[model samples]
Target: MDQPGLATAATQLCGISHPVFQAGMAGIACPELAAAVSETGGLGHLGALRLPPAALARQIAETRALTDRPFGINLVHRGGPAMFEHLLAIAIKARPRAISLFYGDFARVIPRIRAAGIVAMVQVGSVAEARKAVADGADMLIAQGVEAGGHLRGQVGLMALVPAVVDVAGGRPVLAAGAITDPRVVRAALALGAAGVWCGTVFAAARESNAHPAYRQRLVEADTDMPRYRRGLSYGWPWGTPHRAIPGRGGLNPWRLMGGGLRRGDKSALAGRLSLYAGQGVGQIHDSLPAAEIVARLVAGLRTGSDSPPSPQGQEA
Candidate 1:
């Protein structure tokens, strides 16, 4: 069987051979994982949200050292305008193939990215956000549904959100994200007019990822009961936005525990108790294979129908 022909905006925007993208997962995304995906003909993303300017530069350099293939940098949009300027400065120096922005406006940075000959991709969780991103000159729009892990902006599921964003984007390319762990979903995204798919949880278990062993194991052992709300963990995100993750022992339901009366002390306590950070698709993950191997399997899975269940082996802590 041949790989499914599911091309979208990613192909034209970033020159990636495949429409599959490795979402920029904070803490786990690194040069090794990004470069490996790029080498395998998919778009790889490096999360620069927590890195200092110097560290971001070093990571970009490191990725370049591994492969000259096209890769992108993810910038959390809420980090203020200065963060954009700083990221732009580094992007100018690194000259990445693409730059993805999420959780903030892209008006100021889009032009700079385009001026630097880099494609600008914006991640949007709502129809309003998608239209705004297009108006702001984003070359590609990632329609991230609420089913996605990490910081979600709205409650729309991928099945409905992808088509909505695609319609709002006009002629622009749209990438579908959220709980897309199966090839059939990949096919569905394309059918919904998405040019590609951006996956985060699928690669969290990759060997090149920096996720803690315990975290990876939790993802593998995840069940339908795994929590995917923001109130469970504390990472200074006061927005109370919903995020997906596997719930561990001592995990408190932010809603039930806080009971709408949150205090500074409560925030502190919750931060320490909850594991925080992960996607609902965690249950689909099985092992910590090399980035290359993960990509190969995804490509293979798309090409041939494999009845074998996903491996349940857990990585060592």
Candidate 2:
């Protein structure tokens, strides 16, 4: 937790020791995973997109019990204004270190978040979105490149998108998101002017994540090109919006058969049909490790070979 050399303004803003942020993969990132990362000095996040009020509150309490260190909750604003407001109310009452928001307009809610003494973070896909988030009074911005897994926010790749967003961040810490699967990539993100990194795919396979065993196996077996970005047709989500997922046998994903009916921790065969959301860097990840070890390896590159990398067998150190 005393990794001062790896600290960035973004990490400082979140009060975490390292600049690694575990992406709030809705229905995937669990309290255990978030707590482990936070305890290890990186920022862990509870994905609150699919949770009910009671579940979200319970998760907040569970995370608190696991670690006294700071953690955050992630909510998707585009889900619905009323639901967003309801979740925001719960988040403000629970008062996590920060709340990271994605999709829709952040301006309408950043004020209340800041007023509640919570750091406001917005994830944007394009430079225009970055400017809007900055103007909306966001404390931090996550530049999500098209190479990222799950729902894509921007069509630009990480290499071209990060610096552009950084330039327009209005001095707010900007975190690079996409295929941040290894420490070397983390270092490259910093070189691109990103204050930190927000990672999702790699962490979704963490030992403690809520990702089903089938999904984890798919990630381990996946190649860089296995994931394909397609319109959100199966889910009850808007048809125009695109999301990335690894196809199952015969290039078919079971999620296409169910619409908004899946829940986390469901161990049935239907659980195997859950969309395997992952980044292009899935090839580099081959094993499930503790969230803390993953955090250690991700920050190891910041030392520039001065320190030995974490000894995780399946992943690139």
Worst 10 residues of 2 by lDDT: 255-264
State the lDDT of candidate 1 residue by residue for 224-262, as single tens digits: 457456544345445455566544355454433221211
Model 2 alpha-carbon miss at residue 277, Å? 1.1
Model 2 lDDT tens row, 32-110: 9999999988889999986888899999999999999999999996567777888889998999999999988877789
lDDT of 2: 0.82
Name the top lDDT candidate. 2
Best by the TM-score measure: 2
Model 2 collision count: 0
